[model samples]
Structure formats: C-alpha cells, structure tokens
Target: MDDKELIHQILQSNNGIIEARQASEAGINNKTLQRLHQSGDLERIEHGIYIDPNYIEDIYYITQLRCKQGIFSHETALYFHELTNRTPFQLQLTIPSGYNTRLIKDKERFRFFYIKKDLFEIGKINMVSPFGNPIRIYDKERTICDVLKKKDQLDADLVSSAIKQYIKEPGNDFSKLLTYAELFKIKDIVRQYLEVII
Candidate 1:
C-alpha cells in the first residue's frame, strides 16, 4: 500500500494513534512521518508517538505504550477503582524487576514500582482510563494491598478515606482483598483497615 493508505489503515485500527515503529513495519519511514506532519495529516505527541490531527487523545494510553510492561498502581490504581476522589498528578506504574526503564526518555512523568517477575502480574486487570484508553491496572483488591504496603509514603487521611470508600463501594469483594493480601504479605494491615471501616 502507499504511504497515505498505510497510515490511514493504522490510524483506523489504533483509534487514530500511531507509533513510529508501527509505521516502519508498514513500510513508512521517519521522513514520511515528518512529511505527514508537514502536510497536516498527523500530529506528533511525543518522540515516536503520533496521532491524526483530529483525534482526541487518551494520554494514559500513550504513557502505557511507552512503558510496555507498566501496570497502573498506587494512587492511579485507586482512581481507576474509584476508591479515591483525588486525581494523581503523576501516574504510577508497576513493572517487573530487572526491566530497564532507561529507554523511556520521559520517565519523570511516572512513579514506578518494581516487583519480582513472579509477582508482577498478580491481580493485573485491563480497564479503560477516564479518557477511554484501555490500560493495565491492579484490581481493587490488589490496589488495597498496594496502598497498604506503601502506606508510609501516602497521606494517612487519604489512605483512611480510600479504604472507607472501598468498603462501601458495591461489588467490592473482601475475599479477593484477603487473597491479594496473602500474596502481598499485608494481610494484617489490610485486615486492620477493613475491620475499622466495616
């Protein structure tokens, strides 16, 4: 296919977002991206991330794409689970230990947690961000365990409030929370919080 057609097909499949590598795979090159930008067909959002000029961006999806192994965690996970009302200024991502994040040039925008590879995928689930981009995040149960594990770094009031909110939220499963607590080794802390709230 020609450059324009290849770009069009990619844009259509990816909700209007395109990456440089994707273009390369389709036989389009860096010069073509620059040409498309100059011609007003595409807008570059980051170093290698681009989108159709008309597309409304899902910024977190772009972030997730940048950190391929990142799973939304901590405050960001709380927001996804609706256990907290405050939006996190910096997104939190958890990646497995030994994964190099140096390749992500814009790493300051995220706070990362490194878990052992064996534990990295625990309670990982896919959910749409507020902007409607699908992302990997910890389930509510695992989020609770995470926050409890890192409570020292979080505001006491915020931690208390999030646990209270989760306790009241319909469809929350205490059994799942308990299970994750075992994996996270924060069962006593989680139990204490739940006992106080429930």
Candidate 2:
C-alpha cells in the first residue's frame, strides 16, 4: 500500500533483487531506497542494485544487470546450455565492438569478447542462471559457432567435448549452426568437425 510495501513486493517478484531504476519506475525514490539500505532492510550489491539481505546473490544475473549489453557466450553459454560439463573459470561475455568495457568493475572476473554490432544479437536468448535468475546468453548453435571460431585460443578437449555433446543433442538445429558458422566465416571448419562427429 505504501513505498516500503511496494519495494518488498518488487523484491519478492524479482527473486529478492531490485535495481534502483526498477524502484524508481515503481514510483519509489532514491531517498526511500537509501533509507531502506540504512535500516539494513536491503543490501547494496552493485552501484544501483540492491537485494534482501537473506537472498543469495546470483552473480550471473548481477553481472548482467551491471553490464546490460553483455550476453553470456562462448564456454559460459556452453555450460549453461548443458553442452559442456566443465564450468567456466571466468564468466564469458560478449558485447558489441567499441563498447566501453572499462566501465565494468572487477574485470578479472570475466573474459569479454567483442563482436560486430550487426552480429551481436544473433542467437541471443534468455536462460535461467544457476541461481534461478534470468540472464541473457547465446543459444547452443551460436555458442558452438563461437567456440569453433576461437578454437585456437580455447582448450582442445573442451571444444571437442562441447561439439560432440551438441551434435548428439536432440534439440540441436544443424541448419542454424551452419548458418551461424557461415556468418562467422568458419563454415568449412564447422562442417569438418560435424563430419568427424556425425
């Protein structure tokens, strides 16, 4: 009925997380948020993000909130899509070329890839983070294409495993995989791997 109740409702609906922008949009001002934070009712996790003290932080979702343009990709996407069993050591995020990644704090926690703006959104999809928060990531086909494109820089076994698992996935779309491979200029390489695996 009031600002505090509205804030609690927002937090409850958003997995106990709330962004200042979201609160503002709900007609609760910054002053109210600050008051709540001062009273220990909310914890400030990032610059403009807050959460209930009892809530476990979803690093993936929090990172996405901090870097709105970032989409989990490469090995991170593979792990999320169940194409790989290995968990990534660092979060892999892709953003449009020329985006200022320097603005992202804790740079060491992530491995960022830059892509042409035109191709940035290709195969982007919503996936639930391990913490059950919604996060943006690349679909399986796009992730396979991306990993193949960077095969030289990634672990050979990891790449091989991901490709093998992807090929065996019942939901995989080979047409989309090849289409994305063509766009990444790795069509021939993709076919070579597919031929070997399939």
Candidate 3:
C-alpha cells in the first residue's frame, strides 16, 4: 500500500493515536507527519505521540501507554474494579522488580510499587479506566489479596470497607481469591478476612 493508505490503516488500528516510532516502522516519515499536522489532519498530543483531530483525550490511557510497564494496583486498582468509593489522588502502578521506569515522565502523580518479576503478571487484566480507555490492572481477587496483605500499612476503615463491598458484589470469585492469596503468600491473612465475611 501507499504511504497515506498505510498511515491511515495504522491510525485506524491504534484508536486514532500513533507514535513517531510506530509511524516510522510503518514507513510513514516525520515529514509526512509534519505535513499532516500542518494541514490539520493530525495533532501532536505528547512529544512523539500524535492523534487524529477527532480523537478524544484519555489521560489514563495516555499515562499507561507512556509507562508501558505500569500495571494499575493497590487503591487505584480498587477504584478501577469499583471496590472502593474514594478516588485516589495519586495513581498506583506496579512494575516488575527489574523493569526500567525512566520512561515515566510525571512521577509525582503516581506511586510506584515493584514486585518480584515472577509474580508481577499474576491476575492481570485489561479494564477500561474511568475515562473509558483501556488500562491494565490487577483483578479484584489480586487486589483484595494485596490490600489484605498490607492492611496494617493502609487505612483500616478503607480496607475493611473495600473487602465488605467486594464480598457483596455478585459473581465474586472466592476460588480465585484463594489462589491469589496462596501465590502472594498471604493465605493466612486472607483466610482471616474471608472467614469473618463469608
């Protein structure tokens, strides 16, 4: 296909956004991007990130995309899974222990947690953020296990409230919770919480 056709195909597949690197891989040069920008066909949103003029901005997706290793976790994951009523001021992100995080620009807006590489991907799921854009997050089960494991360090009332709300939600998965608890080495604490609620 020709340059314009190829660029159009790439933009269509990428939810109306594309990076300069992605464009280059597809043989769409920077000059072409500049031309498109000059002609009002595309807009530069973040450094090398560009979007079709019609594309809606999604801050969550942008943040996740910019920091590819960041997996939403802790309180942020709780909110994303709808297990908590309070919105977190800072986003919580977890990355594998050895993953380089220099790509993340705005460190102030996020709180980072580093987990062993072996367990980093456990219970990971793709869910839409509040802004309706795709983001990676730990599932409710993993999130519950995390909060339970760190209960002593977190707000006791909030932790209890999240667990109580999670238990009342339909389709809650105890088996998955148990499995994640075992994996996180917090089976005893999780069991204590479950026994009280179940």
Candidate 4:
C-alpha cells in the first residue's frame, strides 16, 4: 500500500491516533508526516504524537507517550481497577527515583511518586484508558500496597474505602496483596486492615 494508505490504515486501527515514531517505523518519514499535518490530515497533540483532527484526545495515553517511564499508580491505579470511586484530582504517576522529571512538560499536571529502580516495575500492567488506548498502570495488589505505604499523605477514608472495595471483588488476590505488602515492608499494616475488613 502507498504511504498515505498505510497512514490511513494505521489511524483507523489505532482509534484515530498515531505517533511520529510509529509512522517512521512503518517507513513513512518525518517529511511525509509534516506534509500530512500541513494538509490538516493529522493533528499534532504532543511531541511525536498525532491524531486525526476529529478525534477526541486521550490524555492518559498521550501522557504515557510523553513520559514513557511513568506508570499510573496509587489512587489513579485504584480508580482504573475500580477499587475506589473517587477520581484523582491530579493524575498520579510512579517513576524511578533517578528519572529526569524536568524533562516532562507541564509537571504540575501529575503527582509523581519515585521508587527505587528495582521496585519500579513491580506489578506493572497495561489497562485500556478511558479513550480505549492501552496505558501502563500498577496492578490492584501493588496499588493497594503503594497507597498503604503512603497512607499518611492520603485520606484515611479513601484508603479504607479502597481496601473495602478490593475485598468485595471476587477476583481480589489476598496472597498477591500480602506478597506485595511484604515487598513494600507494609505487610503488618496490610494485615491489620485486612483483619478488620475480612
């Protein structure tokens, strides 16, 4: 297929979104992307990210694309897993301790939690964003452990509610939850909460 046809197919398959890197990997050069943008066939959403003009922007997907190392975590992850009903006022992201936060534009849009590199990938999982784009986030087990670790900075009601909601889910894994708590050195705290709830 021709480059334009390939681009059209990519956009169709990706829910009207495309990335410059993806186009480049598909053998379409930056000049072609620029030409498409100039012709109003594509809209630049962020550096290296583009979308069809009529498409609604997927903020979560775009954020991950811009900050590849950031993983949705804590309350944000809780929301994604339906462990809590409250929407986070500012999206929460977890990044490795040494990651360069300054490189992220609009830093105020996110609340970042930094962890050691070794622990960064623990319980990482992909979930579809509200816009139907796959985004990296912490699994429920890890998210609970993380919030428990940072309970002092969060609302007690929110924490309790999350634990309660998680307990109500049929697929909830106490073993995995405890294991993550142990890894995070919050096993006793997690157990105490579980004891009260269960």
Candidate 5:
C-alpha cells in the first residue's frame, strides 16, 4: 500500500534487505526512505542496499547477494565448511575476471579474485542454518579444484592436506573435478596438475 508498508513486506520477504529501486517500484518514494531513516526504521548497507536493521542483522547476506553466483571458496570456503582449521586472512570470493560488483562492505580481509567460470562448480552442500534458514555451502570437490588451479593463495601444505582429505572420500565426486576442468581452457599448468591428481 504505502512505502513504509511496502518496505515492511520487503523486509520480511528478503530477510530485511532490498535493492533500493525495488522500493520505488513498490510505490516507495525517496522521501519515504528518508523519513524511515529519520525514524530509525532502516539503515543503508551500501549505496543501493538497505535493510531493516532488526530483521536482517547479518552482513554476509548483503555480501552474498552482491556476489550472486559467487560462493565463498578457497581458505574462506574451507573454513566455513570446516574442512580445514585455517584462519582466513580475508573474505575471498571467486568471480569471473572483469566481474563488476558493488564495492564490498567495509571490513578486514576482503579478497575478490577472478576465476574461470568453469572453476565455479564445486557446488552447494547442505549446511546448518544461518539466521535459522537451512543453508547450502560450496561443495568440497569444487573448492579444492579451484584452490589447486589457483595454487598461489592456498599454501603448499594446505593444498596438499586438503587434497588428501578430499581424495579419501568415496563420494568425493572426483569426476566433478574433471568435468569442471573442461570448463577452463586447459592450460598447461592446470592440465598438468589435473593429470597428476585425477
């Protein structure tokens, strides 16, 4: 019905966040947002992002929405999956090179690197609820393959350890590695590594 009412529905629908333009499409005017902020009904997470602070408290949802197809990977993804115990130096998200995205929310250790799209596979695994919704994580197979392909960020020890751990599983989906490898250009270094491992 009105801006505040529409915003209320958006908050409940999108876990407390919505793209700014959506407000307008729903009949919310800029003046309404200004009024809401004045009344402390909303807060800006970024230029075009806003949230009802109470409904959407977690910052990662905003970050995740920004990345879209991006899944936290490498050390960051590994830490989240509990596949490794390493402390991450930053929040790393693998995206296509030339990937344009909103400037990341201010914080420490925010890392964004471009990976070939083919490397994006190691898909979602069932993860425990975040803010009470069942979440899925980037699967281990895809993560390890991307790490191996990148190789720089993942230290020799960590890479080797992760590989060994991943390989040990009967359902590890090792073939997913090969299938995803076909997505890349088959560079000599990556191909050589895959040949040795798979």
Candidate 6:
C-alpha cells in the first residue's frame, strides 16, 4: 500500500499519534509528510511528531512524548495517584536533568522540570486531564518526597492530605519511598510522612 494509506492505518492503530521516526520506517519521506499535511491529514504536535488534526486533543501523543521513562510527578502526581481532588491548572512534566524539547509554540501551560533518571524510574500512571493531558503521577512516596524537596511551595497540610488519600487507596508503596528517601537522603521529610499519617 502507498505511504498515505499505510500512515492512515498506523495512526488509526495508535489512536491518532505517530512518531515521525516510525512513519519513516514505512518509507515515508518528505514528499509523503508534505502530502499528508497539504491534505490536512497530519498535524505536528512536536518535533518529529505528528497527530491527527481531526482529534480535538491528542492525549496519547503528548503524554507519550512528555514522560517517556520520566514520571508525571509532584502535585500532578498526587492528584493522579488519587490522593487529592484538586484539578491542576498547569500540566507538569519531569525529565532526567538536561533533557530538552524543541521550541514549542504554546508551552505556557506546561511546567517543565527535571529530576535524576533514577528518580524518574519510580513514576506511575495517573489520570488524564480533561484536555487529554496525561497527569503521569509519581508514586505516593515519591510525591511526598518531591513536595519535601520543594517545601517552599508546599506545606505540611498539603502533604498530609496527599498521604491521607493515599492511605484510602490500596496503592501505597512505602518501600519505594524508604528506598528512594534513603538513597537520596531525604528520609526525614519524604520518608517520615508515614509516621505522621498512621
């Protein structure tokens, strides 16, 4: 089948987001991408990424692009972990320190930050926002720890609420926090919340 037809199938399978590199695997070239765009078939989401413009929002595409092995993290993570009822106004994205994205047109709503790669490994899946933005939340232990790291922006009450909700869910991972806290030496703050809540 032709590139156009193949691309259609690939995007259809991916729920409308395709890696530009993946398309190249099917022998899609400049001419092919140009044709798709000219025909209004593909919309650029980020560098070397394309999505179906028809969809009001491309959740899978943007989520996959932002987190990767990185975690959704911080307050956003707490909400996703179901530890809070608050809906975040800004979407958070965490990457390994030094990770970068190409210039984006409307990045005002994105809050880009970084943590070590080892820190990112503890990230977990959270809910998607109404906009289809993935709120890739960090594990509870990790969320508390992150809050501690940014205590200036957070407080004991916020941390308390997150932990209280976390206990309500069967998703608590104390070991993950202890291990990370000890490894990073934030035990008293991030790891000690367990003592405060229970």
The candidate that wins on TM-score is 2
lDDT of 2 by residue, 1-198 (tens): 999999999999999999999999998999999999999999998788999999988889988888889999998998998878887888989999988755355666888899999999999999888888889999999999999889888788898998998888797799998899889999999999999988
TM-score of each: 0.87, 0.93, 0.80, 0.90, 0.71, 0.77
Model 4 ranges with Cα > 4 A deviation: 101-107
User: lDDT (CA) for every model shown?
Assistant: 0.85, 0.89, 0.83, 0.88, 0.66, 0.67
Candidate 6 per-residue lDDT, tens place, 94-183, comes to 677877654222375656567777656664556565555554556667676776677676546766777677756675677776777886
TM-score preference between candidates 2 and 4, better one: 2
Clashing pairs in model 3, backbone N/Cα/C closer than 3 A: none
lDDT, model 1: 0.85
Please give the range of 10 consecutive residues that has the lowest summed lDDT in model 3. 99-108
lDDT of 4 at 192: 92
Name the candidate that leads on lDDT.
2
Candidate 2 residue 178 C-alpha distance from true site, Å: 1.1
Residue pairs whose backbone atoms clash in candidate 5: 90-109, 91-109, 122-142
The TM-score obtained by model 1 is 0.87
Clash tally for model 2:
0
- The residue ranges of model 1 lying beyond 4 angstroms of the native Cα positions read 24-30, 38-40, 103-108
Write the residue-wise lDDT of candidate 3 on 1-198 in tens digits.
Answer: 877777778878877778889989877788888888889988887677778878776667877877788898888888888888788887888898877765445567877788998999999999986556688999999999888877786778988999999998999999999988998899888888878987
- Give Cα distance to truth, residue 96, candidate 3, Å: 0.3
The per-prediction CA RMSD against the true structure, in angstroms, equals: 2.4, 1.6, 3.1, 1.9, 4.3, 3.6
Identify the runs in model 3 with alpha carbons over 4 angstroms from their true place. Answer: 1-16, 34-47, 52-56, 103-105, 130-132
